[model samples]
Target: MGGRILVADSVATNRIALAAILKRGRYNVSMCSTASDALQMARAAPPDLVFSASELPDMPGTRLTERLKAQTGMRDVPVLLMSRDREAGDVVSALAAGAEDVMPQPFNELALMARTRSLMRARETDRALEQHQSTVRCLGFSEQAPDFAPAARIALVAESRARGIALAAQLKREISQPVATLDLTGALAEADSAAPPDVYVIDATLEAPGDGLRLLADLRSRPGTRHAAIVIITDADNSMAVANALDLGANDLLLVGFQPQELALRLKNQLARKRRADLLRASVEDSMRLAVIDPLTGLYNRRYAYAHIAQIDELARKTGRQYAVMLADIDRFKAINDTWGHAAGDAVLAEVAKRLRDNLRGIDMVARIGGEEFLMALPKTSDIDARMAAERLCALIARDPVRLPGSDQSTAVTISIGLAMSGAKGRLSLPVNTLIDKADRALYCAKAEGRNQVTVSRTAA
Candidate 1:
């Protein structure tokens, strides 16, 4: 099946006709003759899209839209209203009342199907974001609502500069946000300091027939504009162009040129949806960072290090390359904390982490696995190279003194390191815990020999 659609029309012929068209497109259709019934049905099980005629037995389609918008679950569902005639006021009113788009009868079957598909695609995107957000919330991390106003940025790209300017001027009257006019060159140009537009109104037949369509694909490929809402303006009779436009990632479309009020409503709807998605994406990134990052030292935490080591061990077994695991402990960290206080000890840990990261190769893994103990992994390393790296880490820490936060005084710091390898090439790599244990024993030997030095495991050699 294509998707689920709820169709509401008082007229039996109208309901049958619309349902038949949708059924041919493979959409699962549910029919209702009154607005109240439609609302009740939707409450029981929400549909992907809602299609209703302007006049119902109990309420107008706009009233239905308002009611649907009020419901928390159905707020994101797209409502398409059908009007008896293409009256500008009715279209504007319907859209302003929160209908996704208002179709004037008798609507072209091809255009209706294209719009349905586009709306369904958008609805699915919203549902996915919402589901992910719910999952994040279940993990005990909730996203804060965005503080900034929803002042969406708009870009108008037309066939000519004059047309773009004219459209921009008209759109400015309908919406309060900033609007800019751009040519094809400007539209596809590389990003700069200026923020990318939140919604782009692009002409489908710019200089040539398919030029705008090509531009749509290019914009989607670009990282900066890929998530922006794209609305295509094409001829009402251009069925093929409309189909291709929706297929190429156009979020919405405007046929029969721009009607300022209708266009404004569509732009606003798209902006709201885009902003919600952006919020969800940001929340996911923040949650992931919190899960794997050490707050004090700004290094990967023990959990992340353990998981990474498993991957590295698997790779070494396949390639038959030796890898190194090292456990380093700050010398007399408890003494520092006892003498200077916890703040100074924290400062030392942060500085030591920085030094270790700076001295190691980019591919090396450095993580703070304990209060003063750090874990480091180096792939494809020999025992001699591992010992040299460990020595370098020890020297780097002892060479400098870290200043206490909010204090002028500085204290010298040093770390003792123990290194172990995953055996020579052509041998199976040791288990992650086994390598870690060997490194730990070597570290004990280092502490016994001297406070600040490097030691290698005998078995590893």
Candidate 2:
């Protein structure tokens, strides 16, 4: 099914007709006679979209939409209302009452289907984002509360400078953000700037044939502006141009002589959609950031360590040089937790992590593999250099005390390190786990001998 659609009309013929039209488009459709019945059917199983008659037998379609929107899960589903009678002020009232779109009588099938496809595309994108947000929340990560308003860029493009300026002036009265006019020749150059427009208003009736269409197609192909919202405005009755604009990825179509209020409302909707998309992109980036790093210690976690080690391993094999792997454990970490509380233990761990990171060369990587345990990797390194690096790490930690939160007192902590060297001569003779296991054993020996020291795996010798 392309999508699930519910049709609500009091007349049986209206219900059947709408359902047939949607069914032919391969939509999974359900029909209902009244607003009450529509609400019941929707609650039973939510649909992707709802089409309702403007006036129901018992209630208006606007009331039905309000009822559906009041439902917790159905708010995101679009509501489209149809009216055979184009009465004065009816469309505005229906729109104000929460209809996603109000289609008047004698609807052109082509235009109607185009609107349906556009709405479905937008809904599908939102659904995917909602599912991703749920998964991120399930992992116990919360989005940082945003404080700033969106400053979406709006660009007006036309072959005529005067016409572009006129459009910009009208947009300025409606949009709170910056609005700028660009010539057809300068559209791509402006798009390539540091801050590209979020929404584009292109005049389809440019003096040069297909000038606007070419720019629209190029914007869709460009990486920087591919996601932008494109609205096409035609000054004349060019049905072919309107259809072609829709086919060429125009988000909205407008008549050039339309009222500025109508254009403002449409622009507002486009900007809202753009802002939602931006937020979804940001959310995914943030989730990816959380996946690899430890929240408390601010260090790469175990998974990241293993993945990076594989990259380092490949480099070492190509270079035919020895690399070092070190496992470090803090001495008496549990005792520190028990005596000074977990706060002091956390402070000590964070401080030690900073010391380990700061003392290492840019070529080295350090990660927190377990509680009080850290793993370090150095690619294209020798055993002697590894030893000196480990010694320097130990001195950095033992030489200073960590400042505990909410207290003036400093807590003392020390770490032990176990290092193993890779095979020489451009050969990765041992697997990564083998090297880790060898270092683990040496770490055990260091802890047994006495904490706050370094030990080399016998296998390395």
Candidate 3:
């Protein structure tokens, strides 16, 4: 079926014209002569796109837009405004009132078609996004959480056959998805063809040879099922079952013998809590990601680099070991910006940052401190190791020519690096800033000697 469209206009002629155009395009069209009628139709069943005239018989188009947006389910629907006035302020006002697009009087066929197509595409995209988000939220993964694809299979484990049947009924009634229930004693191995349940609920009691607790323990031990959210249903109010369940890695515990409302509430609450935990985890990951990441180049930022160095320094002091820091700078970066463009300069910086990150070990931290400057913290590394790492990074960057995006042109980017180490058994007392300064001084010496080389900081006497 073609896309659905709602066309609202005060004049019958304009409505007829738009309906004809939409019909020619094989779209399902609904016509309303007033804002009130349009709103009624929209509430009855939302359309893919709404086109309303600026002046409606009952209310202004802007007011209608606001009202439509205020209503649940209709807020995300796109509203396009049509006006006879060509004034910029009028267009701006309509947009501010939540109209996704506006077309002045004497709408050209081409412009109308283009605007209609764009708004429809945007609305479809938004619909897909909302549906995906809803699925994620249902499964206890919020927008902030890591990417969790929708589950194709669902599993429920209950000891009582009657209770299992009832729970399955409730799931089917509450959620518009397929769900399968299994006796806690049933072998999970049997469900190998079906994808593992994204969520697993285990009843505390089992009619099987062994109790459900054993099954829960067995599932927890299996590496494949370790990440699944496990909800344990129990009648046991004592601390032992709860503690044991938690110790066995159950994500939640649901008490049985409650009213249906209570059971549903508990289920919903557990799901929400799981989603919240996932969101928090994602937030922490994103924070950690940003902590070391330079926004422009996607490299680690200075704060993380400093913290990494501090950690290494502490470890080295305790173990009578040594580590090194490398400070690097781009030579004549300003000249490139002046001659080519800030875009070209940015390209060069990004390339350099990529090279630095690529050359470092996974445990090593590479951070961009400022414009054209970077720092690397290497743990369990000596001065010589640091020098070698820096030299390797410099050589790699110097060898590669950075090709600017959207352009055929390539530019040479070179880096000068400085290395410094904390002496072993001397208990390096230098602060993070001091260590960076020592590395920076060496970097300056390298730059002075000649660009694109690595220099070591003078060893402490």
Maximum-TM-score candidate:
1
Model 1 scores worst on lDDT over the 10 consecutive residues at: 127-136
Q: How many residue pairs clash in each candidate at the backbone level?
A: 0, 1, 4
Alpha carbon lDDT of residue 109, candidate 1? 83
Expressed as tens digits, the lDDT of each residue in 1-461 for candidate 2 is: 56779899887887887777778888888998889989998897788899999999889888988899888779778888888875435654655566665765545656667667877877767765654455455555548637675688888887689977877787678667788888876789977888788989898856688888878888989888988999888743565676677777888776656555566666777777777777876774586477867777887788767766776676567546688999999999999999889988888888898888888875577889889999999876778889898888888889888888898888788889999988986457899999999999988998898878889999775
- What are the runs in model 3 whose C-alpha is more than 4 Å off? 1-284, 288-292
Write model 1 residue lDDT over 172-290, tens digit each, in one string.
89889899888888887632325788888899988888999999998888888989999999886788898889888999888865578888888988888888888887875586478
Q: What local lDDT does model 2 show for residue 376?
A: 91
By TM-score, highest first, what's the ranking?
1, 2, 3
Give the distance in Å from residue 90's predicted Cα in candidate 3 to where it truly belongs.
Answer: 81
lDDT of 3 by residue, 123-235 (tens): 55444334333433443434354576353345678777787888888766655446678875453672343455656777777775336678777776766565456777765
lDDT of 1 at 218: 88
Worst 10-residue lDDT window, candidate 2: 131-140
Model 2 regions more than 4 Å off: 85-95, 235-240, 290-461
